[model samples]
Target: MSVESGGGTQAVERAMSLLVCFTDEHSELRISELCARTGLVQSTVSRMVSSLDRQGFLEQDERTGLYRLGPMAVTLGSIALNSNPLYRASRQSAQNLSQTTGLGVNLAELRDDRLFYLANFEGAKSPKSFTMAGRTAPLHATGMGKAILAELGDDYVRDYFTKGLVDAYTPHTIVDAATMERALQEIRNRGYATEVEELAFGRACIAAPIRGRSGRVVAALSMSGPLSELGLQGRQEELALTVIETADEISVALGFTVTRAPARRTTTAPKETAR
Candidate 1:
């Protein structure tokens, strides 16, 4: 009986792993592609795919044999999003920020060393038919990613680039470790970060880290737009301040209380020590 139970558990895990193989970029995939992604034998993958299809976790395209997520997956995703406290806390604030600024507002959390967008509100000035709610961006290439990285320790940040930065999405991307380190330090000092045409040409963003009640960085908030707009010569500081304030609002909503540093008492330097 114990052996049978263990086998059943293994089967369930494999089936879940198969489901996880589908993503925004690879939403529709063939069984062979699934095998390559999951490294499972064709027979095992085929059986599990069939089971998933029947259970409404996956649906196959009858004409192309490509499989895509089924309704059950969508239902579960909705439930998960609705249940997330961070998402709930930031949704309205993100909406308001986007509406007021006419710039995209994004909320994302760090996952697997990448920024995974949980919600996005497109500005009225730049409406899009789709959203980035379920997409991931590299940690080294986005404002939110940099803002979150600024909250991490120096040792961790150093180790993060030990393998060196990967994927330069645009010519302006910071590819060298020294440059990235300096940028993160600036973010730490300013309480916000900026991305100037790093992820895509003509695009820029300002972002700030969000902390939870535990005083740990839990996510980041950002305002994104065309470089011509967000990168305006005189308005960068204003936009950055707005982004930081909004992010702090979200952090407070998440129960984080700002801990102000004690003011330093300045004393006039001792009379010149001319012995």
Candidate 2:
């Protein structure tokens, strides 16, 4: 390879490595920490970080001198969401997940405690699977609905249950307010929700919530199959994670930003480090 091209590639790689170093656990970092994580010379790291800051890919806290992801990253993610590629890939992903697991996949939004499917992909072998793309499913009965409600907090959920608003689609449906409250808390903890024969006998599903740029639960993505196929009764943790990942991908493409604003700051320089 030409020396110039090799140097360009190396610079790109180094910049990307520095970007990935910031994670949920390490949202902000010091120059020394970046050098430690990337194994790049301190001076090289400093130079690249300044370039990234200039490009708006990273922002340094003026007071504390820590670096975190900047607004441009979120803007890029937002742009990707509006691009056709994400929509096409989102549909194909639904189809691929259905094909991979032999399950029906659905994309839905929560409306007044109900799940209204906007798109549906039925598994190859599960042609008979009912598609609710244009229909609504009860919140307490379906995985997607429950997943949405899980993010609405405890008070709203409690009101829903106490008002006798839950529909008992099956004997397994959770009608008790206390029980539903606990389940929602569990969903918050686990980052997903599951329903086994609650919506319909022998049909089970798992779902995850999708957030928008506002960081609110805007929709849900779900997977459904035979109770036996999903192993809902036996082992479905892997399936739950997969469904959550699917929703997360769509959320990212939909311009959902995970970064929080500065912890605390004034128009003047902050007195403390921005968390």
Candidate 3:
């Protein structure tokens, strides 16, 4: 590559890295902190930050002199979420699942190598689960992640597994990419995914993929709870089936037709037995 092209790529990378530095804890930062966190010169950080601010990607408080994510970011995110047909149809299904199972239900979409929560429903029970709407989870450790991966073909799954798995909440999390790939393959065959103490200890989740009109998987519907409340053996299959049914309902609502193959006949009765 030419030096000019490489320099431009590096600049874009650095700017994106800087933007990612803002998180739940440090939602706002000053120029000095931005330079320190990004390891870039103050002049370069200031110029890039100013350009981002002008483009409505970053917001700077006039009095506090702190920068946070801007309105355009929220606007773009809103547009992306609203544009998903599966998410639009699954809102009621998620609520119904939450009510029926008395657990937390969520719809998630796979994006940028992560599962992004699109819609969520909390049961009427007070003081429910702590997960928030719009939260993101790694694709190797959560049921929703597996469900989305199961929808993609084997080649896509292999490429995703090569990216490596980062442990998020628990030690049971599948850190090895190969194992995760195998697990996702099984999930694809089974038509659902289950997470038992993988994401959070004592928490179990079941998810199924929501397909689009063209039979492409677009999102996942999941139900989660504490393991003790959800039995490990008997209830797991039942819960998985429930999630699958709910996902199919959502898919149908979104205009995806479910066509079942005809069952094969095993054997024919003997002619002598007809007497």
Candidate 4:
């Protein structure tokens, strides 16, 4: 490669490396931190950070001398989000579910073995769940994450487990690999995932996978509420059925067709009592 071309490539890589240094845990970073993490010289890191600030990929706090991801990053993310059919379809479904169920609803995608909450809704009269867009939850501890894991099938889930991605978040969390494997199988058979204070001490959730036009799970939709009300043994099955039904509607909107064989049945009610 020509010297100029190679230099340009290295500069872009350095800039991206600096940008990635700002994450949810580290929303802002100093030059020294960036240099340490990226393993780049302080001068190179500073220059790249400055260039990225000018380009709006990052912004610097003049007083603190720290850099954070900027508006352009949100703009780019908006562009990508607006183009996703699942987001568009699931947003409305999530809103409707929250309104109808009077509970908090979440729309999320599994990314890098974690559930990245894309949108959240709280019903007008419902107590709010502690969640919001851009928040993340562990795959092995949340309903939506488990729903996506189940949709990903055993091979993928096992491979991901082999990477040691599963973590216990609460006393109710299922961390044993074999037990979780059986739980995922049950989720698939039942067409939804359920959580009983798995992620939080007194909260429960039911989640179902949303499929895409390709008939593969692209995301998950979930409803969450208090353990006392939503986690009653009798209510879990009912709520799971409701969530799965709604998820099926979203999947159809996204182009997944139910493949059940057609059957005809006649409903015979005892002739209205001739009273």
TM-score of each: 0.86, 0.60, 0.71, 0.82
Clashes of each: 0, 0, 0, 0
Worst 10 residues of 3 by lDDT: 266-275
lDDT of 2 by residue, 3-96 (tens): 9999999999999999999975698999999999999999999999999999999999999999999999878855654564434446767888
Compared with the true structure, what per-residue lDDT tens digits does model 1 show for residues 100-200? 99989999999988899999999976567887987899888898998888788778777778766557888878777677888776677667777877888
lDDT of 3 by residue, 210-267 (tens): 8889888888888877776666455655676688888888989988887873111111
Screening candidate 4 with a backbone cut-off below 3 angstroms (N, C-alpha, C), the clashing residue pairs are none
Between candidates 1 and 2, the TM-score winner: 1
Superpose all Cα atoms of candidate 1 onto the true structure and report the RMSD in Å to 1 decimal. 7.1
Which residue pairs in candidate 1 collide? Answer: none
Q: Tell me the TM-score of model 2.
A: 0.60
What TM-score does candidate 3 reach? 0.71
Candidate order, lDDT descending: 1, 4, 3, 2
User: Counting only residues 3 or more apart in sequence or on different chains, how many pairs clash (N, Cα, C under 3 Å) in candidate 2?
Assistant: 0
Ranking by TM-score: 1, 4, 3, 2
Candidate 3 regions exceeding 4 Å error are 1-19, 38-67, 70-76, 124-134, 166-169, 175-182, 232-234, 261-275
Cα deviation of 147 in candidate 2 (Å)?
0.8
How displaced is residue 116 in candidate 3, in Å?
2.5
Q: Compose the digit string of candidate 4's lDDT tens values, residues 73-192.
A: 989988877887777887887889899988888889888778888888887645664547777888888889888987777788778778977777777788777888888766766677
